[model samples]
Target: MRELPEIRFLTSGDVTGAEKSTAETAVRSALAGAQGTVTAIRVTLSVVADPALPRPALAQAIVDVDGRRLRAQAAAPALPEAIELLRDRLSVRAAYLRAS
Candidate 1:
């Protein structure tokens, strides 16, 4: 499969380089299996200000597949976990979009 053109990562200082790589890998892996003209891919990682929340870390992805937009989001106490969740969710959604 041809490599994705560019993956834009939107994050704050709280997000580390390792976490960005992890998120990028996860998104690429998920999108690799998708069947379409992937025009753009954007992943956002953020930490909620409220520490009281159970899952402060957030991962979100927006993929432009054949001009259609598909989105997936996940939250966890840790960035890695959130990225994992995002990958799985995005994979499923992508597959469904392809099927339909």
Candidate 2:
């Protein structure tokens, strides 16, 4: 089967940042590695200040596959950690989506 189509995400909304490429690459990597057919996918991310933490903000990812959306929100001590959490979360979501 063909690899699944995926739209990755990142801190930046547009496709011009590490996070964007990171998100997209992860999905594409996951789907491609599994040899699954891709229908459609979209991932969006936003980094905003955290009102409660007195920090820059948090990283939130909203992913859409076909007609379903998977949201992963995490507040880590750092952006890298947040991305890691998001990756794990998205991975689980992708697995779930692929199964059913």
Candidate 3:
């Protein structure tokens, strides 16, 4: 069996848990954990802040595999949720990629 492909997490500003996008070793990790048959993957995160209102951070990950593409985004009270949601989306895609 082949190992999981890499996974990349890109961020704009200080996202609580995750540092700057591609900080530390995200690029390396993503390149290592991408199990999905995603021929290509794009992870982009933009920080949207409202002073009047405290809103949860939003996260989105877009995966391009062959002619099929999958996009996942989740708005959670915390940054972790956003990450998990995005991962779940990718996981589903990974499964599909592995199966087919």
Candidate 4:
């Protein structure tokens, strides 16, 4: 069996443990179908605060596959949504890579 990719999460601002776990789970599910195509994935989550209200969370995902880098970013009201969006983008890229 092929080895799954290593996932690293770098978080900033206010991030709860549950949020982190959700992001990791989303990434894992996203990559489940492309196990052999990806070697490592790094996700960065940034929470920005505004004087009036809190801004949406920003998530950036970088996937390393065969020495090539695939990146995607998303901003959402919730952390999990942002991470899931990034994962979805990566999944699309992974599919293309597999086909090529």
Candidate 5:
């Protein structure tokens, strides 16, 4: 079995343990399609202090596959929504890269 790539999580504001864990799991699951090509993954999540913003939660990720890099970002009113959006974006990008 191929080993999973190293995943690093960075957070700002009131990020929770569950959010980080869920983000990690989502990234790992998405990378399954890309598998051995991945070298590392970095996930960043943050919550905006301002309450006026329509989308206060932000999530982004950078995936290093071999020597190539793939990136995705999303914003939502809730952290979980941003995480899921980022995960989906990453998954699509990974699959596209894997194909070519």
Candidate 6:
């Protein structure tokens, strides 16, 4: 079986330790099944917060697989949720890449 691609993350903004961990885990899980297909994975996360809204967090993710790049943006009430949204979006793109 081919080895899974190395995943590198570039993060910025108000990301906390726990949130970073969660995002890493989510990215790993999201790409776990892509084993022999993916050559490399890079995910960039940018988190934005609004003082007026204490609950929701806005985040954007730019995912690179092999030489292709895709972008996804999401807003959720928590960091994990926002990360999950990004992972979900990337997973779809990954699947499409594999199919083609």
Best by TM-score: 1
**lDDT (Cα, tens digit) per residue for candidate 4, span 1-100:** 3466667889998888888877777766666666356777898888877545454688887888778777878888777778778778877877776787
lDDT of 3 by residue, 38-61 (tens): 465566554566545454566676
As for TM-score, the candidate ahead, 2 or 3, is 3
Worst 10 residues of 1 by lDDT: 4-13
Model 2 TM-score relative to the real fold: 0.55
Model 3 segments more than 4 A misplaced = 1-10, 16-37, 51-55, 96-100
Off by over 4 Å in 6: 1-6, 35-40, 53-56
Model 3 lDDT on a 0 to 1 scale:
0.55
Residue clash pairs of candidate 2: 4-38, 5-38, 8-24, 9-20, 10-19, 10-20, 48-57, 49-56
TM-score for all models, in order of appearance: 0.94, 0.55, 0.56, 0.81, 0.93, 0.66
Task: Give every collision pair in model 1.
Answer: none
lDDT tens per residue, model 5, 1-100: 3577678888998999999999988888877778447777899999988999999999999988888999999999999999999989999998898789
Decoy 5 TM-score against native: 0.93
Alpha-carbon lDDT, every model: 0.91, 0.55, 0.55, 0.76, 0.89, 0.66
Clashes of each: 0, 8, 9, 0, 0, 0
Q: What global local distance difference test value does model 4 have?
A: 0.76
lDDT (Cα, 0-100) at 73 in candidate 4: 87
- Cα displacement (angstroms), candidate 6, residue 8, comes to 3.7
| Candidate structures ordered by TM-score, highest first | 1, 5, 4, 6, 3, 2
lDDT, ranked from best to worst: 1, 5, 4, 6, 2, 3
Candidate 4 has its poorest 10 consecutive residues by lDDT at 47-56
lDDT by residue (7-94, candidate 6, tens digit) is 6767777777777777767777666555244555565555656667664565555555565765666677777778888788767766
Highest lDDT: give the candidate number. Answer: 1
Q: Could you tell me which 10 consecutive residues in candidate 5 have the lowest summed lDDT?
A: 30-39
